[model samples]
Target: MHDPKKLEEGFGDLANEQQLVKEQDHTRNFDGDEKEDSRIGTNQPMEQNQDEQSRQQQTTAVTSKPKNKRIATLDAFRGLTVVLMILVDDAGLAYPRIDHSPWNGCTLADFVMPFFLFIVGVAIALALKRIPKVDAAVRKIILRTLKLFFWGLVLQGGYSHAPSNLSYGVDMKFIRWCGILQRIALVYMIVALIETFTTKLRPTTISPGFFSIFPAYKWQWLGGFISFLIYMVTIFTLYVPDWSFVEHHSDGSKRYTVKCGMRGHFGPACNAVGYVDRQVWGVNHLYSQPVWSRLKACTYSSPATGPLREDAPTWCRAPFEPEGLLSSISAILSGTIGIHYGHILIHFKGHTERLKHWVSMGLGLIILAIILHLTDAIPINKQLYSFSYVCFTAGAAGIVFSGFYILIDIWGLRKPFLFLEWIGMNAMLVFVMAAQGIFAAFINGWYYEDPDNNLVNWILQHVFIDVWKSERVGTLLYVIFAEIVFWAVVSGILHKLRIYWKL
Candidate 1:
């Protein structure tokens, strides 16, 4: 124990081990740092003196990966939908394009609802990915569905007109059961349930490969496809009392009549969708002022057919909502497709991979829809929520979503689009406010009476209407300006307060 030479040797060995451990730790830390850097952005050469070319390359790589983790694209896409919705809804004899197509074809206004529904699907998918408990997910779905339905009824339901007179409350006879919010709520419930059950039963592991791309949960596809098939089967096979145009000369009046089965019954009277809606909710409970009402005085060609005669029964004055009962079944498919897209967004790590998938699928859907429509297998009718219509609109929605994703999420060009994000973040709030006439009432009350008369009318009449020299364009711009300023301020305040109105 007292051997000096042997003790010195032992101490030397211990010192050597300590040094080795330090070196290993240093190496591990360096490797970890490198990995983290690469995860955020590509690693660049750290030379003592780097050339300009290499420096430029590094800059490019750094900028390529956006600094923010938020998906600006979704917000922007939703915001765009909301903006267009307000614009179209507020349109005052301004543009036909802002209005829905008479019956069969689509207008710019028609895309708003389907696009919103698709976005809802995508949102649900993203949300459910982290929620492991099926009961919790179902509870969320049920509560949201009920809330949306109740609010829809309260906002748009036909209540007593004499509320100011203190006569009574809601008129049960005129209550609208199927409305925009009601339909959205129903669709959301069905889709959420499908996703919940599928996610619980068919949990899947991600396959490694670019071309191996598919839904993480295959049951989602199965559910969506089955819904789509159901819609097609029902449309082709369902039997109802036939509708036909009846011209009465004695009373100098005309009305649609029910006759037999709907074979070539594509008009307002003979279509199965309108027939079912009338039977279910009754005509008085449906939308009374559809875009078709304005087009009643004019004769036009049937969108499905080439040309129609003046007396071709193209006039349908009945209150038929495009978002009717039967068409909503196919709407589920649209939302399901959106869910698939949301899965893609969550699963794929690389930006290129996500963009590639979106573009390919979107273009493919559009082409297929066009083919089906041209072949007359399924006409693109928004009123019926035809298969081709669903495909076409959903495809357009995908492409739009991808474009926003690229601009806001990938390129980091976010500042300029913050307004849209603001509005989008509070979508339900804005929608409810607008639907409840809060915004309209506020804007209408903002007027200060002037010497010449009403200031609001004066500005609208003299400034926009007179300057633009086109009532259609001027009135549209005025409403648009008002909406943007008013909603933007409200949304901005909410954003500053960090208030997000969640379902």
Candidate 2:
């Protein structure tokens, strides 16, 4: 509905076009003893050559739009990432079939989050493109970014406690540590600052008398490269036998607590860091989401005759907390990689009109992902958010974005995945609702069972999940479908109400 490009151009035109340019150097160095100036009498044959050279430069100066063009493709790219996230996340009931986001190994599921983050970077870059860094605007940007970060942290930490309002006397120990919202908020703050001073979406080339630059200048793949390198170095260093922190442990022994509890089976492990993560690795360790120990015992086995070594009952703040600051570095890098891929589409601003370009970007990212996977330098683990993880995931996200653009923008087909479009348009709202337990609470009270009864089982029985014989692939899809429908109806209602929950 908004012609953002026109608005950008209108804003850019406020300053004199002459002031926008510099007295640019046309060549490296040229000596004019008037020999470089005229030379007509000395070499009559050179006249045509000089004219041709002038014409060539003029041609270079006269910029043209890329062969194909579409901005709607960006919309599709944005929508596609949101759709896949819902698909993978809601499908958790179907373990092994769709349970891809555990730590260590990566799958098709991990890409969507990074891709979404990357898109955020791209969009922010675009939004800040034309604005000059006036002191007021700079302050506004900083404050706004800080606000987003604080709010994100709030969202992530919300459900851990029941009280709606937080008071001054609330215990710090009661507050849950970092989470999805907190990470998003922190990363956005970091990214916004980076983009603000760095000039995120602007390009480098100057088409004499024209205002344009090479599209690749937009921050995307390049940023991924840098973030990946930094993360890889950290991971490699973390595992080093004589790393800086190796000496921090009490004993000379490498034996570390793989799982931690005062009386539980805590013992030496290969790495102290791993020991910490393993202990805190339970779902219940996460705020509000109760640590679901004895799951196997409750459903299929004896009711706790003994504790299994790998999956045992333990406090979540175990020595092995995976979401530690060190590990989160990897996750943040994953987000950065996604941002880079988003830039790939962004840089093709002029060329998007052409169908082939969009297709190429989509396919190219897929190929790149494969290459990164084979190398294994960029592992796809969601929990660890390894470098390879970011690479492959970002690439996959890019391909999805491209395909959506081709169908929706290139072919002008808008209705096929209106489901995705609706969800995409109001993604943040959905993310908050879904992650903050609003959806889960509503379902538990209505579609699902009450608090006293079995949690997962009741949801499986009464919800749209009933179509399936079990909580496998079919069940997951059913939930995803219902959620999408829920979101779609909500989006429509918002449209009718003319209310946008703008952050």
Candidate 3:
């Protein structure tokens, strides 16, 4: 046992020194290659090592940055449009002021269609930002267009009657062809194709100092103006001869003849819009209950729908689709205007610049609309889709969109409008389910007593109407609760689950 403890301590010190030397070597050559060298353990080319480190740093920077997202303002505006549509469709009967105008004037409901079309135009601009393959884009667009047309046929083509009847079928011989969705389909197709073909013009290529605010979208504006000219010329020049149609009441069928051999007439009776639809789609295919029926000239009560007046004109009962061919041409201009606004969103980065442009364009449109309408140059008419109506509605839509952008995007106040944003994100789904009454019709099918005593009726009678003791107030509340809030919740859940129904 002579000095055994000292020998063990000496061995431990040697091991510790070796370990520290290895650690220092590893630290010095941290960016070494996979291959090891006997002399230095591992070593890499300095250039390769620098490149790898640069790549890692770039990846980290990219991961740290926030992702670009969809504009919340657009979705919110669309949601607002859907909300208005539901309110009008469900509660318009109780509140006639919010209902569509009988003729020649705009009401709250009258703005709904233009707002919708304007949104479509804006969306088209955003969606078709980069259409590398024209054929593929066209194919996709055509598919969507067909789908829209199909749904329009199913929902508005007399296939499904909700709350009133459980039956679901359409008479092909007498099925209506034109409707809200059908018009939307046509507009989408036209505008999308226009956008697809005109994607060569880059926003940067056009100088901001150019006289035209929308310098890059000049071709689209030209197309829109051409369409307007076509509409104006046809509407004024087309000869609308005397037309006759059979009106079927509960009593029996009555034949009525409208007296008109006019070249220029925008009255409820004799118009080129109705004439073109009658000639192309036939009277049987037209909308049976036109908005013109609500006019004082046609009904006993003005604005509110009522019985036909004793001295009602012959065209009072005639079928006239509001979304006819001639008027749809004017509607294209609305979408074009919307695309111009959207282009501003794409070209401009600064919040102040975007707002200034949008507000200026909106005020200009509003002023033009006032002059045109007040001067009797072109009355603001929804049925005709008059130029003044397009100007006023599109201008209002731009203003509304800009306001939402300020509140939701610029100010970071999105949480308050998250419900609307969700609904807007899943707008087509809500349109089919709530606005179209497919879901209501399905629920109404499950009944307790007779068919009239369905779930929808029961809820209305007991829950809303009975509790309020006022039909109008109850009906409004029911629509708000049953349709708006209910659909908003459904949309929110779908959004959370990442389940979007797109067309």
Candidate 4:
């Protein structure tokens, strides 16, 4: 007799538990059809560099693993992240304010990467159980890592402004060399390799019926803690060196720039990193408006220094440099924290209600992150991808996962979020499309421009202003609506046509 009411108890034993989980493993069903359609390198090798490599190799693509069979919730979450990515990414360039902050400050759009990375970790945990052979897995891992790294370079290439000549524009060679997907690729390979070698020691066979591999999830938790601590240590220890900065106005005293802290002027969160990144990462180098405070630093000056004493320039302040690789440490911990949540999800097995479990933990994490932030123990900086960011973001992701799981899985209310699911299904394609020169260069050339002249601005100024219905939130809402419509249509079309994409 088994307790049908209790989910985990349905399994008779470890093998039975594996069988139960297998039944729910949606990834298996996707293997033959969608996998091939995407033309992902499942067990083949590919060239290391897109630009340099002339030789072609075959290998498997490490596409996303459906967390479980028929796990619509996971798919939905992935789609949700993609949708957010597009909106934040594709929105009419609002200049410095709308774009990502460089170092410490976060905006409405900053959570997007953390969400995507967390999903990557979540899917990896589930997929590790299903790899057919170790050799094939290794091949897939290398190819995928290279592909991601290459893509990251492409993003950096398009955006980097550090040129050898530095005359009228930027030089592509020394542009920091990495981006978001590149980091994800590195972490994914590392985690997969770790799983491969360690799990091999046990040699537990995962028959189609079921399989069981007991991993101490404590590792997951510890990894998050370690990453957070190490990141804080690094941040506090290392001071960013500055070689370029324009001087202040007539006042031989310093000028203040906004930062991510409570007193916005003291830190460079709002200005320095954000301005520099926006300047460097755009199609135009320093002239790209908004974060165009070229030569701004990321630190607040001392009152005594007057910002522009004979010793230093008057306009000194901290710089904003979000998307700085250093901040990625916070982003990495987001994945690590997410891994712990996955571990806990498996560990709890029963007792806690799913959504409540996720929600409560999320709230707790938010509080903790805020507290840590106040202590300056772990600053919450999106630019630095600080641990505070990890705590808040991971908590948010966990709650989201819980809510969707309960609604779609437990409550039996699974409807296709086909709109999001479509992009989710072919995430690689969607992102590649986003970065490719052919699309963005051509399309955005026509649509976006004069960030001051965006439709959101137009609507709010013309219609809302005339009607005396002025609300800044409405501007944000209008933008959000536009984003939703864009993703819904695009993703829906892809989903309906069964057109999946890969790299």
Give the number of the best model, judged by TM-score.
3
Model 4 — TM-score against the truth? 0.61
**For residues 202-240, could you state the per-residue lDDT of candidate 3 as single tens digits?**
555446662455656878888899989998998889999
Residue 62's lDDT within candidate 2 is 39
lDDT for every model? 0.66, 0.45, 0.78, 0.50
Candidate 4 residue-wise lDDT, 1-503, digit = tens: 12211111100110111222343333544676456635644324655555322221322123443233345566667768766666565442433344555435555467777877777666555545444456655675677677777766655434532211111222553244446666676566655555445544433332221112224444554555665666555555434333333323586734343223321122443323333344444312221122322223412332111123343322233333344544554465666655545544544455353344567778888888889888876666665566677777777788788877777777777655656555566566555554222233333333354534444446556764445564544544544554455545775676566554443
> On residues 1-503, what C-alpha lDDT tens digit does candidate 2 reach at each position?
11212101001111111111111111211333224333432444545547766655544443332322324445445556655656666665354334443334554555555766656554544444444443444565455555555655565444333112222233344344556545554555555555555664456433432213223444433554555566555554444232111112365523222332322111222333343343444322333322222134222322221243454423211222334444455555545544444444445444453334434544665566567657754444555555555555655655566666667766778877665555555556666565344555544443224353544345456664565556565566565655656676786576456444444
Clashes of each: 0, 26, 0, 49
Residue 153 alpha-carbon offset, candidate 4, angstroms:
1.7
Candidate 3 ranges with C-alpha deviation above 4 Å: 1-66
**The 10-residue segment with the lowest total lDDT in model 2:** 7-16
What is the descending TM-score order?
3, 1, 2, 4
Best by lDDT: 3
What lDDT score goes with residue 141 in model 3? 72
Q: Worst 10-residue stretch by lDDT in candidate 4?
A: 6-15
Please provide, for model 1 over 1-503, each residue's C-alpha lDDT reduced to its tens digit, 9 standing for 90 to 100. 01111100000011111122233334554677446545445445566676768766765675464432446676667778877877776673466655677666778888987888888777666556544456766775787688777877776676522111222246777677777777788778887787777765544456876555455566767777787877666666666675443333576956665456654345555566776787777866776555554443433632211233455343444466667787787788888888778878778878998888888888989999999888877778777888889899999999999988888888888888877877777777777665344544444444456333444566678878899998977888877775665676788787777665655
Models 1 onward score TM values of 0.75, 0.62, 0.87, 0.61
In TM-score terms, candidate 1 sits at 0.75
